[model samples]
Target: MADIAAASHMSLATVDRVLNRRKGVSSRTIERVLKAAVELGYLNPEAHEQLAAPRPPNIVFLLPMGTNPYLRLLGEKVRAVADAHSRDQPPIRCFFIDSFDAKALAAGIRQHARWADGIAFMGIDHPLVREAIEEVGASGTRLVTIVSDLPHPARETYIGLDNQVAGRTAAYLLGRFCGGRKGSVALVAGSRTYRAHSERETGFLSLIEELQPGIEVIGMREGHDDRNENYQHALALIEQHPDLVGIYNVGGSSDGIARALTQKQKSGDIVFIGHGLTHDTRRLLIEGTMDAVINSDPDQVISATLAHFNGVAQASTRNHHLQHLKIELILRENIPLQYV
Candidate 1:
């Protein structure tokens, strides 16, 4: 203590306060004491590095406001992660917006960008939204896309599954599950404005035509990821197609479809595939209503976002690998015990 006080040109009392991380010590004094400690070999290198690290930036996550169980789970995970790292990491705030309204979404981005050093969102592919992202980028705020992506070059990175691959996987699973029996399939989407949903639909259709020609896609309907709406859409599809053997949902609200199938007495009869693994989907899987679920880990998504903001080398590597998340296929047999 005395040596550090002498080296830093301060009293023993000030050195004690700085070492103990007490109140009333200016940042400049703290730095002086830390530097003195480093030169005198009183502080370990790792400790010094940690103490000298820059203050974490403020970041915001813009999520969609909806009834989608998967999206709800994602928001919860984000809050939990932010709370857990409150001391050493960037302060994270989340805002739920009307994702379908392009103008509102654009406005939300611009508003949040005013105060946040970094912003991440579930991007909608709209001209206004793209323009907003570009404008925000021009203002020097870093941006990232989560779950969905935009074509704008301003986005720093994207963190989510490869939707096209997920779509093809769904097609393969449905075709194989149908046992080559000739029948038609119906597709349900939350919204085509989300590039993820559009990509998944495109991949599903292409693969079904190339490999499962016997299975025809009758039509697609937008349910906006709402349970009641998706339920109506599913029922309508069942009524319209007597030979429906498969249904692939490129978005959320799998429970609505499951309920519709149950009401129509076709739960186990039709091969059903969807995205996101939630409690409702898990129950459906156990009850033989849903065949398979394609998902990406929400925890991993949050971790990768934090890594990008922190700018640590190891975390940067993690962020690079996590740009395209690994798709997880969950079935009735392989459902994790924790989720159950």
Candidate 2:
């Protein structure tokens, strides 16, 4: 590795940073080393002594786990990471909940605070849920929320898109895509009980009202945070307003929309915009049935959450970065070609 670094004319310390993906290395520098490391079989320091000797910090990730295909991938990424970090330190103990039940999720988080060095959780809003989070904080747990955020009693750091801005940005794209075809816009969202979806809907309608006054905003349906619900609701929506010109998927169910749109006679009748960078969304975007998907870098969420526990808590990212989160407007023209 040192020989490779020498050949590349970079310091060994710089090579180490590139190998481990430690921040502070410029993207250009990282690109150079990564290009080299890909060709090299091993990273420097034969054994992961640094990570193991200094025991990686204990971080409890409190998020949803279900049949979610994208989350399944996220879980694999988090777990694929070396458990013992560098073969010397105590292994990072990661725990997860298998359902979205608020009570169960709250309980799972509470269970971790006893011995955990810190807790990083996805924020959920609701009086009881918010109170439960506060209770965890009182117990001295470091909390964090991703994608959708928790308000009032905010967490130590939020690690996802500024949802409201994301929603507004989606609206902007939808308006641009609409090309002034004055028509009603339907919103498909998860439970209004969830703050993130609620805020996105709010931002969406606000932008539509301000920018496209002629465009009608239809009242939304509660997706209930369920895939089947999104599927059923989306079909019902098309049936309700056969002339509906645009769709804003605030929270759940991209597959539901594509499944609904499939077999239809219309090719690209109405515009669609939603969140997340899931494989299902990718396929739909490529097929041209779904229109635009706004992205929030889920990997960044992982890194940000890890950062707080790793000892450098970022207060606020740039507004554009927060709004975008490496967010891409995925359309048929520029959707990712492969999941790999």
* Best candidate, lDDT: 1
Q: Lowest-scoring 10 consecutive residues by lDDT in candidate 2? A: 315-324
- Tens digits of per-residue lDDT for model 1, 1-340: 8999999999999998777654346779889999999999999888777766655667899999998999999998888877777556678888889857899899999999876778889989889999999998787677889998885667878889989998999999999999988999999999999999999999898798778788899878999999999999999999989999999999998999999999999998999999998899999999999999998888888888877866742222333233898999999999987664
Error of 2 at 69 (Å): 3.4
> What is each predicted model's overall lDDT from 0 to 1?
0.86, 0.67
Stretches of candidate 1 exceeding 4 Å from the true structure? 1-53, 312-322
> How many residue pairs clash (N, CA or C atoms closer than 3 angstroms) in each of the candidate models, in the order given?
0, 4
Candidate 2 local Cα displacement, residue 214, angstroms: 2.6
Q: What TM-score does candidate 2 get on C-alpha atoms?
A: 0.75
Clashing pairs in 2: 48-86, 52-88, 52-89, 324-327
lDDT score, candidate 1, position 83: 77
Clash count for candidate 1 is: 0
